[model samples]
Target: MASRSPRTTIFLLLLAVSLPFVCGCTDYGGQGVEQWSSDIPGGEAGDAVFNTPVQSAFTGEDESGTGFALQRIQPVMDGAAATEPRMFPVKFETREYEIDIDVNRSVYEGARTVDKALPAEYWYDEYRMLGYYSSFIGDPAIVTFLDDVLSPLERIRRSDNLNDEEFLELMVTFVQQIPYDSGAPVYPRYPVEVIYDGKGDCDEKSLLLLGMLSRAGYDAALLLFPEMHHATAGIRISTNGNPPFRTFTTSKNEKYFYIETTVPTYIGLYSENYEDAEAFVVPLGNGEKRFTRVNYVCHITESYQKIADRLVFMEATMAEWKQEIEDMKSDLQYGTYDTQDAWDDDYASYTALVGDYNSYVEKYRKYAEIYVYIRDRPYDIAGVYRRIENSNVMDITI
Candidate 1:
């Protein structure tokens, strides 16, 4: 849900092809390295393996540094629902080669207008930490927290034999399960603190999950929804994936699949408020931070097909219901309906069918409206899945 940047990062295309779906991870689990290739045109991305920790970055001792001095404060698990401070690896893969990153001991929290006087460090989209050599500021504390979060799940993930595509879903589910607390003190909490605190608001949770994705080697970025006071992560995903959502192109034009971290969801799914909200894409120094576009269609073909199927079924059902009602009315009007008991039974059935028909009509109307919306909206297909997934769940009504 992150947004609100002085700059506009929206790339408008009324309809673009769906991003490629994540493929199976094969045997890349355990210690084997997985190499990735460039799916987007401009980037020369190839081979990235998260098999080993970026050990060297956290190794060196810093006597003095120019960057912001940050100490890993032991976070207090004040609430009973805290995550108990455990680490779980983010499981994903790219078909590229290995790339090295140097984690700077002193990380710079880039130049953003900071009202030093403000009591709560309400992080805004303007405060995108400098993402250079210090791509992810490495602190022993943050590293350990990440490990704690990721380690416990290694066995379970391995046991499930999850592929990269499947792994992304699992990873997102893990982040969503974290309890949310809006009362995080003003300052931005390190991934460690967020984990220890157990509850995190949108921005805090987004960073913690982003750190995990960085450690696990999936390409991810920051999405600031400033106007909405929300933050979300955008992960690198193939344009052809089944995640019925759209992506945002970085200033460099590299597309990152939008994901909602504060709430548990598959990548590219988000709130209705941001359905057409302009997302500010903050780069994480992952090569090709600039989004790339290939003159594509955005909405899922399968989604459209499903809608068509439903439309056909609804139309057929509506016709049958109408016919039944018409026949029942004709019999009564012609006085050929026989007994009062028969009349009562027929009336009741007619009423029930009327209700059903009305429901179908409303549903079909929504489907058609969504179809038109998807056809014309720029870079937003998330509603297709959101509506489809949550559509039929009913509430009790007399």
Candidate 2:
């Protein structure tokens, strides 16, 4: 979730469209080039990858500029009982599911103890700070702490027999449902802190999602938009059937599909704002998990787009027909036709146009209904598939 102004409203006839249309294009802002060149220690522009070492103790780097060091923050325990479990209610299609995880009081306290300020030497470097942000994802303590929440998710996936893609959706939607709070600290919070507070901004939510995804064995990365000061999580999935909304290929040949966590959008859908912005992909882990349901989601995405286009086309056609009918009525009233036979012929043409216009109006209404159904229920893959399969958009004559 990159920091952005209020989104513009999208208008669709008969129904208000919320999600942005998929552009079906592949543009990775830059070809995975490091945009934060000036922020690096040596002032050299290099590929943005995690080269820092993970440690449990704070150690300053030597002035030789070899590598960066990150302090590992651990939760402080006062030997108290764990706090009450936080409950997250998730809705997938028509079924309602609940996930409950108990956060230890010390874990929340330890997260607060972690310092976000960069060293004085690199205080002015935002890229260095971004490196610090990336370190949290690989933090062993934080990764282990998130397991409490992950256990329930695994249980649900097994109990419901959800496939890889469905499970990915479940994990993503769960994070999306977390109330977005832009008021959170500018620096990213640990996943435990996000869970404890039950709210996070774009970076916070995106980090949490990437952590969970990596822990679940999915190849995930953090997408950084330096220009917009926004961040999003990207996952690598099979594209054999349908292409992703947008993608960035790393220097290592890994292709990551963009996933927006601020809003409850489908996996392959992202904001149009960052569609053209350059993104830096920071790989979290080398997990082998991949989503294989692109074909199913692709069908729903393509169908929704088709209906939307038809509605626009039909609306324009009807408007022209309506104007023609009005003009003919005016001519008849003014006796513009020289002979009675001419007037009769004009009147017949007008009547035929009016009938055709009315028929188009009826068909437009049906297409609109289908568009709204698919738009509103994007997560209902099976239901949307059925709705699209049962209705034929070609039947709506122009």
Per-prediction count of colliding residue pairs?
61, 2
Q: How do the residues 1-398 of candidate 1 rate in per-residue lDDT, one tens digit apiece?
A: 11222211122122233322321111111110101111111211122223323221211222443222333333343334433323332322211111122221222121111211211122231332221112222444454445545554444456667555444455565665567665554445555445544566555566666655655656666665544444566776555443345667777766777665554333455555566766667655243221122122233444554655565555555666666667767766675555799888877877887787677677767675554443333222343345444653222121
State how far residue 308 of model 1 sits from its true place (Å).
10
Clashing pairs in model 2?
2-230, 29-278
Worst 10 residues of 2 by lDDT: 35-44
lDDT of 2 by residue, 95-188 (tens): 8888787776786788788765434444234445345555555555565555666778878887889887788888888887788875666566
Instruction: Give the residue spans of candidate 1 off by over 4 A.
Output: 1-138, 182-188, 240-245, 285-398
Superposed by TM-score, candidate 1 places the C-alpha of residue 21 at a distance from the truth, in angstroms, of: 17
Cα miss at 225, model 2 (Å)? 2.9
How well does model 1 score by local distance difference test?
A: 0.44
Whole-model lDDT values for every prediction = 0.44, 0.64
